[model samples]
Target chain A: MKSLHAQHHPLADTGYQLTVLTQAEVEGAHQPLFATRLREAGLLPLRPTGITVMQVNVGKMCNQTCRHCHVDAGPDRTEIMTRATMQQCLDALRQTPIEVVDLTGGAPEMNPDFRWFVEQISALGREVIVRCNLTIIVANPKYYDLPEFFARHRVRVVSSLPHFSAVRTDAQRGEGVFGRSIKALRMLNEAGYGVEGTGLSLDLVYNPSGAFLPGNQAALEREFKQRLVREHGVVFNSLLTITNLPISRFLEYLLDSGNYESYLDKLVQAYNPVAAANVMCRSTLSIGWDGQLYDCDFNQQLDLLVDGRAPQHIRDFDLAALNERSIVVNQHCYGCTAGAGSSCGGATT
Target chain B: MEKATYYNPADLAKFGNITEWQPEMGRKFFDYYGEVFKDGALTEREKSLIALAVAHAVQCPYCIDAYTTDSLQKGADEAQMMEAVHVAAAIKGGAALVHSVQMMNKAKELSM
Candidate 1:
């Protein structure tokens, strides 16, 4: 693969004309046309497969407000899952043969019932994956012992570390986030989360701090391993490279910064049909805190409900109905189908 | 002389430079970028408009700069482009406000 630096440079001429479109102009004209194209790409109306992983978005409450966060999570948010909703999740898990229990949120740990839910799932003897924001472990004094709790359950920790450096990570996240993240990582390591040869798995997530898609996952993982080991003595199992979906706070960043067209062109031109066929939504089922089903986490955030003959909430979850149901998609689906493709687990292809 | 304290437009435009320290990754991004803009199920014109909309969604000055140009070159009129951005702003703003219901409920319970 050729380097991105060589392709688009400050001085390189790619024979493509660059124009500046404003927020109003883009919203009015380009969006409709883009939607039409998505339909042509066989991505307009998406369909679902089955419910393998039940992802419960615990809430919008988070300690940090990163610039590119798709969830737009911050300390100010309070939309947490109630105990009743959590009981619904446990009921679904008990009745279904769901393989993975994926938990997410502003900082899923911020939920008061987070431990109870984890304990219930762990008792069920199912695989559990936690989308940890890393800093939460050190954000509050009460959360200090979270490492021990996670280690005891053998929960797979998938934490976000935009970059290994303080400048880059802090820039996308917030001031001093990198320092706290490092401390949290060290604590996880102490609990045998990312140490080599340990069965406990700890993976890190990386999304581009700018408008473009992230680099190759394999290569980026190599660099992250080396830098983290040398600089911060941090270790992790894998680096899951994620593409910045053009939604939420990230979308605002693109338009506010004025690079929307080139970035979308980058995603569209890199549209990999192979990647599209293997999109995470094809096999994974995303569930909301209240038990509603979605094609993926992004769709969940958009409030785009899944298509099924029966009701879509967990209370009415029918595995067979969801298995045969079609996934809901739109123009934004292109972000996942583009290039190597993107998902919470990493590249689709 | 004291440096300008205000957020620089140039700084925003040069935001891509943050990845410069990793030239290998930079090259990979360029390759994916080249492919992302090529003609596919989406016409270059359609892709440009989507990028314009997403630029607002992500709020990248550099991306907004490049896609605004791309959208116009693809013959998207001013009204069309602004509408795409409004969709983004609506969703972006709505995402925040919709969750306020949760806050409202919490506040009510706390007051009781």
Candidate 2:
């Protein structure tokens, strides 16, 4: 399947998605504004706690075009980060006490400089997290050594596995993805990535296959552990439950299914203040492939840059001004702040 | 204005508003309902499945909708949820069929 960008779908445009999200009413009923909810929670104009993690989107190039992908990434995507931009990121990291540098992409490995970037980040003595889609490791013979390479650098491997069942997983992802993911997990297990004491972390991410929100994170983790062990003999450290933000391809889905209004209402009704207070945007800065900065990955996808008061690009790297500037938020922010809250690492509350 | 129906989907969201009319009993019932679904001998996930099965048996649209979401939220997969409903179906069907012995006896007596 082609990405929204590749298909020339209207929802692929970030501006259109934002307009739909920000509108106060859907189907003539009041749709709660995310900012007003934040205001009620005493968190309007949400500001950063501090910058501890820099999540860099190395590129939009990816292998699989999952239905709920907010990035709208696929094989056809050609937007990739240059070596110069990566160097700027490394230089920015050098100037700060940032401990974690998260690498994400259509598949970060798809980027030609991926290995070099990982080496550079590791050499800086900072934690590296690769948001790997597990199938990428087993996609081709060239990528087979990914588990060992990740092990060598002590990189935390986080991959999305929507469900353990092939039918459900493949329904959202692609055909034969579950089998490839299982094969990849076994390879990681052999490398001691998710073993008891290996320090090499291999975490699986679970997002609901439908429009509904995910279950309790800890309970989902327990069920995943039991089923993977008993059924497929696969094991992971923890399951990170991420909510599907209504954007890009997912926005297209909501609209096409006539579920846009109801899904937004579900999110608005499920909004939790504690989750709002602990949103990942409070501490993480999202750097786009071209070095443009965003409040978070979702905001990055929407082309919502950081507050203008702060440096707009990674090359500038003003920690103080960035920390002082308020985060740019829209209705899609509801996804992150709904229920227990979702982040790259997992649940906030 | 919108036309009113026998079962308005919008009314489900207003379920909590029952307390506005009769605060004391409503709050107590809700408190008991919440406590009943917590993890005990049966996990919350298990209770959700049971609630879903019961929701189907009772044929409550509000409950079916609520428990379906609740069951999924508590980590019950689609297969497990469907099986729960089938259990409800079997029981409901069996209850009506179990009186076959009485019908057979009445038929035999009338014939004699």
Candidate 3:
């Protein structure tokens, strides 16, 4: 599937996506404003708790265009972060005590400077997390050595596998993706990434394929462990259940399939205050491909920059200013606070 | 009463309003329903599948919609949920077929 950008779809525009989220109303559904909900929880003007994870979107050039991708990332994308911007990120990291550097992209490894950036982050003694699309490791001959490189750096690898079954998994992602993902998992296992004693954490992410919230994280993890190990001899440390935020291609999907209003209603109805207080945006800062900063990846996708009170670019990394700035939010914020709550790690509450 | 159709998908959301008139019974029923779905000898996922099967067996549109979403949220995948529906169908069909024995017995006795 081509990306929204590639297809010239209007939803590809971040401003348009935000407008659709905020202004478009379906008949008979009274979707409450997310900010109002937060206010009710005494969390209006949500500010950062502290910076812990610096999630960097290295690029938007992914190998496959998945249907539910909020990033609108695909092979057709050309939004690669430059070495200079990466240097700026490393410089910012050196200045702040932020403990974890998360690298994500169309495929983070696809960036020419990906290895250099990983080594640089590792040298700084900060934990590195590569949000790898598993198939990227097996997509080409050059990427075959990713497991060894990741192991050498002791980088935590996180990948998304929507479902254990090939049919359901492929339906959301792409055809034959499940097979490639399993092959990549075996390779990661051979490198001892997810092995019990290795301490090299490799986690899989599970987001619902269609318009529904994720199931209980613990139960899903247990089921994934049993199925992957029994059927394919794959092992992983944990499963991170992510709620699909309504943005970009996913927003396009909801609009196209007539699930937008109901899905938003579902998210709003399941809003949990505990989860609201623990949103990843409170702690994680998202860096875009061109060094722009945002509250979280979802906001980054929507072009919702960090509040003007904070430094808007990575080059001007101001931990104090950012910590003081209120997190930019919209209706999409409901996804993070719904049900058990969702974040980069897993359920928040 | 003004609507042409008897069943509106939107009515599913209003199911909670049942408590408005019969608060005591509604609360008790909902409390028991919640407890029934909790993980026990049968996992919540299993129970969701069962609810989905029963929803089909009883042919309740509201239930089918509710439990379909519940089953998905409980981690039951497409194939598993569909199989649950098929189980309900198989039993429903078998129940009617099984009554053929009584029909045959009555027919033979009358003929004699």
TM-score of chain A of each: 0.88, 0.98, 0.98
Q: State each model's TM-score restricted to chain B.
A: 0.74, 0.91, 0.93
Which of the two, 1 or 3, has more DockQ? 3
* Candidate 3 structure quality by residue, lDDT tens digits, A1-349: 7899988888878888887888744333378788888899999889889999999999999999999999999999999999999999999999999999999988999999999999999999999999999999999999999999999999999999988889879989999999999999999999998999999999999989999999999888988999999999999999999999999988888999999988988998999999999999999999999999999999999899999978999999999999999999898999999999999999998
For model 1, what is the alpha-carbon lDDT of residue B56? 87
Name the regions of candidate 1 deviating beyond 4 angstroms: A1-45, B1-112
- Clashing residue pairs, candidate 3? none
Q: Can you rank all candidates by TM-score, best first?
A: 3, 2, 1
Task: Give the TM-score comparing model 1 with the true structure, all chains together.
Answer: 0.69
Model 3: CAPRI class: medium
TM-score of each: 0.69, 0.96, 0.97
Docking class of 1: incorrect
lDDT digits (tens) for residues B54-76 of candidate 3: 99999999999999998888777
Model 2: lDDT to the true structure: 0.91
Candidates 2 and 3 compared by TM-score, better number: 3
Model 3 regions lying over 4 Å from their true place: A24-29, B1-3
Worst 10 residues of 2 chain B by lDDT: B69-78
Give the best candidate by TM-score. 3
Taking all chains together, the TM-score of candidate 3 against the true structure is 0.97
